[model samples]
Target: MKKNIKWLLLVSLSFVACNNDDETVAETPVTAGSANFSKYVALGDSFAAGYSDGALFKKGQDNAYPSVLALQFKQAGGGDFTTPYMEDNLGGFSSGGNQVPQFPRRSYFNGAAPATVSGTSATVLGSHVSGTASYNNMGVPGARSYHLLAPGYGNPSGLVTSPPTANPYFVRFASSNSTSILADALTQQPTFFSLWIGGNDVLGYATSGGDDSSPITPATGVPGVGFDGSYNALVAQLSTGGRKGVVANLPYINTLPFFTTVGYNPATLDATQAGQLNAGYAPYNAGLVNAKNAGFITEAERVRRTINFVAGKNAVVMVDEYLTNLAGAGLPSYRQTTVDDFIVLVSQGVSAKAHLTAGNGTAVPLQDRWVVSKDEVALLKTATDSYNITIEAAATANGLAFVNAKAIMDQLVNGGIRFGNYHMSATYVTGGAFSLDGIHPSARGYALIANKFLEAINAKYGSTLRPVDLGNYQIQYPASL
Candidate 1:
């Protein structure tokens, strides 16, 4: 009986031990997976550089996506990350005793509207950083993908001269006059890298209201190659020698608060006001019918272009080159803007409230940079799609983690994403995402971005870096900073 009791106790102990082994999640330690984070390097454009509120500053650098990512990477065997920080907490840089070309410092919402502080950066720089080896972050604001491969891109001497010009921000920390950004990263022979280029490629065009003067493709073509040769070249160099990295694709520019702040219907009117507005557009409606009957335009276009203002949130008239110009017959390029049309953020306070609705107003039609028309928006969409295709292909071919910037932007615009215990959206202020510029993301937004890259990295490289809590980061830095 004693022997049987002892055997029963031993069996019970063995069963409990087996259950504990299976249930304990804390037993396995998170690792950097197959990739090495000891020498991580980042390269790209403004987004990579931590540009925010129309400017780059010290705190912005601290909250950079790469900087935030490196924090997690550090716990998982990542090396110390570095950034080309501004001289002070006050945003903006002074060169040759004059402020830079942008609006002084950065713009910030004063709780009422976006406004810049009274002055600019008073601090002056003495010289650029000497050693190239110590540099980790090579993100240059306003740099296109091609610029990263372009030699002498950081040369201050070439800024006023020929083919290869210098970026002012790069001038502060560039190691040499002849080294390319890619070359500098190569010098480190980084085991890991993160590339978030290509936004500036379309950003200039988007902000300029579909101005084709700004090309998305490289200006200088490499013959016998496919589309986005520069991008492909960049990928090839970074992926060479089996280096692992993460790259982000372009997002649809229209989804940004820079374009989405103003709505299709902001013009609310009383019954009398609505009637007056309708009478004013009567000529436009009659012209549409006459043009359609004459076969100058389709009946669909006639309907599409006809102006109809309701008592609330009405669409405004604007010029459309597609319409037959009948200026001599009293009809011009004017037509009502469709829902597909996007009013720019600059038009937010001034758009529907000030123009086209008032009787005494010229009704000259909102034009140029005031809005991004349907045709323009469609063009941007096509270019974005094409770029993403190339980006995805490169990532798959090279075995690099791909970050879908488009998806992130879409989620932020449509609904909020969970970060920590809080919900974060892309809305300008309270959204805790975008900065006052309406173009760039705030510090918290960058944290979310870092987590996205980390997720892709963990999936592809098997890295187990934990994501940072978004609520820990600031929504927007004080304008004073």
Candidate 2:
């Protein structure tokens, strides 16, 4: 009787093992062109919103990559995709164009104030009241990851009590209570979703010179969610009910046109100007000598002096104390001063001068005031790594696809992909990829971004979506002065 029982047990275990093997074999592998995105929803910051040339205007917004992808998807048999778009006016940063109104025209304080007035035309993104279509895209221009989870975040009118009035992007799409962008998106019951969050969390800090003193915190912090916390929350909310989607990581701001476009090359200086620079630089050397005499640490002086020429038309070329040290250490030097550098330096000095100083000195380093320093770059990298970890973990946990946008941006700037007929670099204005602002992408540039997304999706979802032909998009060049 015992022998018979043991034999029966062995047979039962073998049958269970075979069933497990069958289940493993039944699991599908992702391949190109196999998966179809029938219904789609997209969420994230300015890049996702199709903000270009430093503004989110009608033409750029209409031609945003998401819209392009949606159109392509529809042609490929997917259903229509909608977005809470800014109808009458573009909502992000503004620039000047050929009688076509740019957005967020320069502030009064900035030397280059826009001649045109700035205000949002009262309209909603998907107001069926005016007979508009319900939008499925929810890419908020300045939204951080935590903003999405904020109870009143999507409420277009919930948080507008103070100066700068209200965010025009929110005002256009916001419904007092019932029609928050996120809530509306959730209610859509999307079959597929695309999310790219957490850019603004670090962006504001980076652009603001890494003060991090502002009230804003990453989704994990008390007053707000730090990047990690907010990212997880976003994944949790989207992944509920077994929903599958795609999420993209943030790119470093340094890679954008804003940073790369303003590089200084000492080689560009004329002989006379170079002599003047060498003369001006003598004081910096004197300062180093003084430090040594005064029993202060003798740091190496930077070879190049970064002058904020915009401080005044006649503003003297001030030595970049920050770059002085950096250059002394044999690091890369700043390119010569440009019109934009002057504007940014003056603007920052005026508003946040207290925070703009080098330790124990009235002399502000160019790296400290205008450009990103090695320390700040290190910090950004750390923040970026933390954010990417969260993004990858969330995607893995939720069975969603992840796009390494950071890597892609780096490659584009460092010569990774050559799109269209032009060999695109990440330089601002003429760089082919970035627009005038040096921060956002042009229409053709966005198409390249779309290809990155497609690659990730195909790899993870067993789908084969053909990348859009670069030739289909337009690349604008600066008008001759």
Candidate 3:
């Protein structure tokens, strides 16, 4: 009986051990499977440079997604990844004693709102960094797809020219006045690379309210002229010599907080103010009616063109080019904004509000530069799709990992993405995903992006790359820093 009891106890212990082993998750060893990580390069626009809170500072550069990826790559034999770091945390740089207004200092969340930190930007754009011939991170803040292949893109002399042929960010660290961005990257002989261009292709147009000043790149031109061709050419060059890389598609510009933060109907007018606005637009309304009666415009267009102000919340008046030309009747194409339109974030600024209060949108109609009409939004969507198609095809052709940044952005805008215990969305500052500028991502948000890149890289290369904990990154930087 004693022998039987001992045998029963041993059998019970063996069963428990077997169950535990079955439930346990095996730790996958870190590896760089089927790929070389000895030299890694990152090429993109502001996002790749970590331009958060409106500027690229040392801290932001340190937390840039490329830098984050390099840390993880270290475990898998990734070599040194150097960056063209700014001299100070102040953000902007000076060019010949004049502060470059284009590159302003980073903003911080002041108790109530975001405010630019007070300091003179000390980094000099003409001052080249010593001892570094080629940088791992080749991200230029305002670069477009075609800009990478343009000669003299880093020439300091081009900075003074009208429209500025050179980007100040690239001019700071470019190898030579004549070397293009692509040329510089190729010189480094990177074994692996990441490409995240195309955002700036449409960003300039969207931010400028689809105005003619920053025209959207044509969808069907050849390389160095159009988005599709330029993007494909970029991929082709990056993939030379059987190199492996990752490419991310462009996200919809409209979904960003920069375009969505301000509402179409933001003005709340009192009864007296409303009456005054109505009286001011009465002549234009009467002219519209006459134009419709004269068969110059459709009745539907007449109704859409009519500007009216209510005593409570009201849509601000702005120019809509899509409206039928009523210039013959001495009437401009004017209409009040609707929910479908997007009022740019600049419209919410103190100066802009004062400009609107001064009868710009009430008595006189606002210009096309302040609002993006529903028609213009559709144009942006079409262009974005065209660019994305080119990007995806390039990835497939090159046999590279592809990240659907559009889907990730859609998730952020529609709902929210969860990482560990925290949730992030595209809600400007409060959402914890975007920076104060509403365009770039916050530090924590970059960590999420890094994880996504890792996921794509691991899946494509069949490697085991560990993702970082979101809790390690901060949602927003403090004002003191």
Candidate 4:
């Protein structure tokens, strides 16, 4: 009886094993569903172009989110997606054999700091790509919304104009000298599209320390003038004939690592140094007090403007134009930075160990261009919110999928979003999300963004598209590449 029972158990176990072997977990086949992706074109600025490590290169373009999406779309009948490929990985095109100072090579982590890659690129300013559809990507870096609608924005001749009316990236693949970004994209008649613009509208202003070099686009104006009107026009034109697409809203540009990585208090000083700095500002503090007494300023304003330093990490002094024009009274709008202020990333080099001795941010107050005051931050927030409203409205009115990029940024800042076992945040290089530039995403970060796009596309279109494994993408590219 024992032998019979043992044989029965062995037979039962073998049968279960055989059943498990025959029943495999099947993957959900990719499908386009109600949406057509046969001819898909992506339209946006730097993010859409995969401008990682502070510059655009071949590898970065290859891993762009649109390219990643196109590969997945191929499973459902999407055709070949063409890109305006850069000539080399060195980036920074030359004009007439002279390297354009504005455009520079890609940056990589050199164990201690972000360094520009060595080598010259063959990409020229007026040189056009050989193919016709190379503009399928249509992502011109440094483009604003209004720039997309302007004629001759890709005209190489305009590259020499004051303030540069043309973009070099667009000039590389534009069909004609007179063609606009919208025109080139519309000529493709893409069945599916993605729009993620308006960041540059305010990004320039924020990065330039709210300076005049790059002004923020106003939210209210006529079509082709204001962000609202220009965005609406873009949607209306793209939605002609009921074409389906996705629209992603702008994230809080001020919160990006370029503004957030550096703290307000990078001015570390010993007790002796702090005392000496305080002594130097004594006359200015006295003048602020006298100005308050003379009705030139309020007591609160006086306190805010008073520059004080202590032993340890003291807030850097910066020029605040918002302060009362005490310049007439021998005061130059000087104030110590607070938590609300952000020292621009470029200020890091200015406040380096060598320069700190020269008092770039201590003895000599940091210029307005090195700091984004609380007032400047408020301006950025207002513009970003206004632009997002127009973007969300366009998406809803056109029945297109919407990506809440602001929320994603919030997630990256608050406690990071996880993909598989890897987690990413906005904590600069260590966060595994933003690249060495501290503005754009790493390769793995872009892969995560591609997954987010897939999620929105599948939910909106009823497609069962699969997300690529996050493990496949690198968190950071090596300097060798």
The number of clashing residue pairs in each candidate reads: 0, 22, 0, 0
* Error in Å for residue 427 of model 3: 0.7
Q: TM-score for model 2?
A: 0.70
Full-model lDDT for every candidate: 0.77, 0.58, 0.87, 0.86
Off by over 4 Å in 1: 1-28, 95-98, 101-103, 123-134, 161-164, 218-227, 325-330, 347-362
Ten contiguous residues with the weakest lDDT in model 4: 347-356
Error of 4 at 447 (Å): 1.0
What does candidate 4's lDDT look like per residue over 101-162, in tens digits?
67778888888888888877789877888856546798889999998898999898898898
RMSD of each: 6.0, 14.0, 4.5, 4.0
Candidate 3, lDDT over the whole model: 0.87
Q: Candidate 3 residues 179-260, lDDT tens each?
A: 9999899899999999999888888888888886788888888888998888888889999988999999988888998888
Q: Write the per-residue lDDT of candidate 2 for residues 308-377, one digit (tens) a residue.
A: 2221122223233344344443333332343323212222423222333322111223443444444565
For candidate 2, the 10 contiguous residues with the lowest summed lDDT are 106-115
Cα lDDT, model 4, residue 467:
82
User: After aligning candidate 2 to the native by TM-score, how far in Å is the CA of 179 from where it should be?
Assistant: 6.2
* Candidate 1 C-alpha lDDT tens digits along 1-481: 9999999999999998977854553455669998889989999887888888877878888898999988889987898888877766657776687766552477677877777765657545334754444478889888877788888877878766754387777777777788888888888889899998888777777776664546555333551123378888888998899989999898899888888776665566677777887798897789878878888778887787777766766677666665667676577777767688876765323433345455312245676556678888877788788878889999999999999989998998888797447888878678888987788889999998998999999999887777787878888776675
Ranking by TM-score: 4, 3, 1, 2
Task: Tell me how far the alpha carbon of residue 289 in candidate 1 is from the true structure, in angstroms, after superposition.
Answer: 3.3
Which scores better on TM-score, 2 or 4? 4
